[model samples]
Target chain A: MARQVAQRDDLLPVLAETFREHGYEGASLSLIATATGLGKGSLYHFFPGGKAEMVEAVLAEIEAWFEARVFAPLRQDDDPAAAIAQMFGTVTDYFRSGRRVCLVGALSLSDARDRFGQALRRYFALWVEALTEALTRVGHPPEGATALSEDIVGGIQGAVVLARALDRPETFERILVCLRERARAA
Target chain B: MARQVAQRDDLLPVLAETFREHGYEGASLSLIATATGLGKGSLYHFFPGGKAEMVEAVLAEIEAWFEARVFAPLRQDDDPAAAIAQMFGTVTDYFRSGRRVCLVGALSLSDARDRFGQALRRYFALWVEALTEALTRVGHPPEGATALSEDIVGGIQGAVVLARALDRPETFERILVCLRERARAA
Candidate 1:
């Protein structure tokens, strides 16, 4: 039982990578099994709920990483501009490290209109709310700051899409820089 | 043959709707066949290359529609703010038509890294260039205008995702209003 648990733990990262690469529908159980060196039956043994459970686990892992590496740093500061710039760095690090599509964006592409969708929605809202609170702390009106936060987050997400499409990180960096400057100006 | 051609023409919109609703990976041949009232064999009959070809056709159809509805209006006059606002209105109409995800956004979410990526890049470049040219035509510096255009486009795409997730059009409208105001202030 302990060995089985260890094996499942080892499988999670590989499964996350596969899901990130091909998305939910495109990533097959066969691919996950192959990547993890597990048979289909073993994969089922680990995740009885199958692909959905695997994806949910992957999302939770990514979300935790995002919170620790990205959101936590931003929430530590009160300077809105600095916090905004830090968030951009987090985004850059995320894409560079994972070479993966944003999980939220990926799930949004599916007919996932279920708990997965709700989780993604809540995740984004939390990010926006965190940024908005920081901005409000820095003296920007709550409404404008929230709007700005939304734009900044949105711009980064869109820029990632463009960057991946063009195979150019510079595009993403340029957009982030643009948003940072705009935030500072505001 | 003429009847077959007409039937094929009628089929494109149905296929496009399926792709738009469920995305590329989530959109299966079976679902598309059901939606279009065609059997699997009949779908294969029309689309010899199957799902990929059907997706390619949908992309083409969407590209044409986008160019007409979104891009064409921007070229009507050189007033940057007016053109940008009008472009936002086009996006509003496009999203409000009950299509939850933009084709470009949806394509980016899929493993479209090679196949449809360049086209998506070109479409975005065209959008940014149009806005940049308009802004530059109206006296903003080329660099600043280009960055602003990126923010506006990115914000709109992000706003759409948020709006769809929340099931509210107002979220998108609010973001667009902020974008327009930022453009005017710039």
Candidate 2:
């Protein structure tokens, strides 16, 4: 049972990538099974609730990632600049240098919008709050920090879209630089 | 004959919305045909090369929009800020306050990345160049302006992604504010 649990954890990342590449509506069960090297029966065994449950798990995983790689560092750090820079590094790494499309962008606009909408909103809200705290520590006033942090969250997402479309990492990199610039400004 | 041409022109907006909502790969011919209220035969009749040609026409329509609304005004006006603000107004109206998804974002990471890459790149490049020129005229150094303009394009695209996912217009509105800030900074 432990071994099976371990294998299922391994499959989650694969499934995440598959969903990222193809939105929930587009990522058929057959495609998920093929990508994970698991037959439909095996996939069902791992995700008994099927695709919807699998998607919720993936979103949960992403939220956990932000907690570990982003908010944790920001909350624990004294240097907001370093914290923000490290967060961007984490972001750049996660998106695979802009090659992997953001599932949030796709699924939010997909037919599942109503179902996944609140979770998506929560994801952005959490990121903005963490970043806002960091910005506030860097001497920005409360209002400006909140607002700027919101822009940063949206801006990073926007950069990912552009970088993906242009098939380049420069835009993503430049935006990261802008994020780092905020830290330097302090 | 003229009536048919006019009817096809009317279909462009509907097709554009469908493509914008569902990326190239996801926007199946049947969905598009249904959206346009046309049968497959009629869709093919309008677009002989089918979806690819339809996408090309949509991109072309976007290009014409830039010429009339963005490029034409920037080229004609001396005040870069006014020109840019007007352009943002046009964009705000077009994207329906950030409810619409961008096709470039959908297609770039799509399977048709290779087939439609050039046109997508051109779409961004032209927008960047136009903004760069406007910035240059307002005293932004040429090199810095080009880079910033590119960032703006990517940033706006990213903001749209966030706004769509969160189902909020504020993020999109904020990014446009940032764009306006740059214009004013010059």
Which of the numbered candidates is closest to the native, going by highest DockQ?
1
Residue A127 of model 1 has an lDDT of 80
What ranges in model 1 sit over 4 Å off?
A: A1-7, A76-83, A97-99, B1-6, B76-81, B97-99
Candidate 1, residue A134: Cα displacement in angstroms equals 1.5
TM-scores for all candidates: the values are: 0.88, 0.90
In model 2, what is the error at residue A73, expressed in angstroms?
Answer: 2.1
Considering every candidate listed, which one attains the maximal lDDT?
2
| Per-prediction share of native contacts kept | 0.52, 0.60
lDDT (Cα, tens digit) per residue for candidate 1, span B46-114: 889988888777777777776776666565575656776777777778777223677777677578656
Clashes of each: 0, 1
Global lDDT of each candidate: 0.72, 0.76
CA lDDT, candidate 2, residue A186: 47
**Distance (Å) between predicted and true CA of A35, model 2?**
1.3
Docking class of 2: medium
Q: Report the lDDT tens digits of candidate 2 across residue range B1-107.
A: 22243367788888888877776666898899789878887788888999899989998888787878898676668787788778778887777767876666656
For each candidate, C-alpha RMSD in Å? Answer: 3.1, 3.0
